[model samples]
Target: MQEYAVIVAGGSGSRMKSDIPKQFHTVNGLPVIMHTIRAFRNYSADLHIILVLPEIQFLFWENLCDTYQFKERYQLVSGGSTRFHSVKNGLSSIDAVEGYVAVHDGVRPVISKEVIAASFFTAAEFGSAVASVPLKESIRSIDPNLGNRALDRTHFRLVQTPQTFRLPWMLDAFSVDYQEHFTDCASVLEEKGYPIQLIDGAYENIKITTPEDLKWAETYLAL
Candidate 1:
């Protein structure tokens, strides 16, 4: 089936304390967002790529693309105030209602092509497939009244991106008014009564929100 990837990159790098957004930061002499786009492009050369970024950052991103001699094709969309709206904008770029769409984090460049393929294949079969990994460390349930108690970590999974879904279903899911609880496409689809399918994702698939994450990605890519 035809596929598309909507890569959202709205980070301002506050946690990384960088002047530029974390997605624009360089890893292994290449921008993080570029690596992310490459992941999808490498997965399927024919897949349509939609990049969502703040309007103000478009020129800068384009200049970076030129500087790196990055020639992979993608349609750029202006980002929204929040991730929900940003993804909505990206989804709107795809004219076709048939096929599958994978919403990914642009800062997460360390994802494997295997996971990318699984996401599309599973989403094609199940309507939606959200990439995730089990929490390795201990977990806890916190409440102001009840204080903190150890909770079963096995029951919880750290949600990652490449949240692939059927194109028509994803478009319909984003048509509703934005909700605060819509943290990911999976959550938004779940609100629309779509069952969320969790797929195995590598632990290396970490979002580059901080300097340490960038370092980790660089190290991972080098190995």
Candidate 2:
């Protein structure tokens, strides 16, 4: 069986307050998305990588690759309007009929090799695996009518990506119509009655969405 990592990057950088997309921003002198790609490349030299980006960003990416002299090999696919649609587009380009596919956030450049390896091996055994972390903050459920209500924070976990799944299972799940509620691959798999296996994720594996997140990523790089 083969392994593939589908990295979805479609940010407009509005939150990061940059003219460039957040994924293209430099962190520790390298593009954030390049760090993400290197993580997967280091994890499995044989693993096929697919980068999903908006069609308009292809030329920009190409220019950057040349400027940086980035010679890593990977396939590029055009993203769709939504994350769900973008992932579906990435999945469609996969040729492996039987294997594992990890749907990861392209901006999450700090993913550890341990988490990536664990998720892949665990998914091989369980058919589905999602990287997650325990919540550190107090929790509450808020309702427009009822205001707010306390809940057991211990029972909840902050879900992250590199949501690994058996290729066939994920391919079938993506075949369904897109739903606004499908925030991640785990949600899509859950909707199809698949049991989600939760694996511990790295705290540093934060999605780069804001300027603060970029700062944090820079801090992590220094550490």
Candidate 3:
């Protein structure tokens, strides 16, 4: 079955204290988004890519692609006000009926090829599959006023990406009207009564949001 990746790159760098968007920021001399696109491309050269960019930054990304000679077969879609909306817009750009779609964060450049292939394979077999990693630290629920609250760690799992789904199933989920609470594609599906399965995701698949994250990403590249 055909596999397509919808890479969402609509985050602003407000937390990073930068005027530029986080995806455009440099990670070891290459743009963060470039690395992400490259990662998927490396895994499957024939895999189709669809990029979702914030309206204001669309021209910037286009120009960067040209300047860096990063030519690949892909389509660009305008992002929305929120991450959920952005993903929805990207999903709309895809016309494939069969196969699978892997929705991923554009800033997460370190996702391994093995994880990408495995996630796609699982999603193709199962109806839906999400990449996740086990929590490494002690779990705690903290309240601003109450301090720490007891919570079960066994019941929780850290969700990562690329969250893979059958194209038809995902398109059906996105067909519903948008809501403020729709945080991710998986949440949208869950609200529609679809069961999501979890797959092992690499801890190194971190999304770069802040300046500190960029620094650590640079260090990660050195190792």
Model 3 CA deviation exceeding 4 Å by range: 143-147
TM-score of each: 0.98, 0.98, 0.93
Candidate 1's displacement at residue 195, Å, is 0.6
Residue ranges of candidate 2 with Cα displaced over 4 Å: none
lDDT of 1 by residue, 3-97 (tens): 98999999897899978899988899899998899888888889889999999998998899889999999999999999999999998888886
Q: What TM-score does candidate 3 reach? A: 0.93
| Model 1, residue 130: C-alpha shift (Å) | 0.5
Alpha carbon lDDT of each predicted model: 0.91, 0.94, 0.87
What C-alpha lDDT does candidate 1 achieve relative to the native structure? Answer: 0.91
How close to the true structure is residue 9 of candidate 2, measured as C-alpha lDDT? 98
Candidate 2's residue-wise lDDT over 51-127, tens digit each?
A: 99999999999999999999888999999999999999999998768999999999999988999999999999999
**Model 1 bad stretches (over 4 Å):** none
lDDT of 3 by residue, 159-211 (tens): 99899999998889988888888878889999999889899998877878878
Q: Candidate 3, residue 153: CA error in Å?
A: 1.9
Poorest lDDT segment (10 consecutive residues) of candidate 1:
206-215
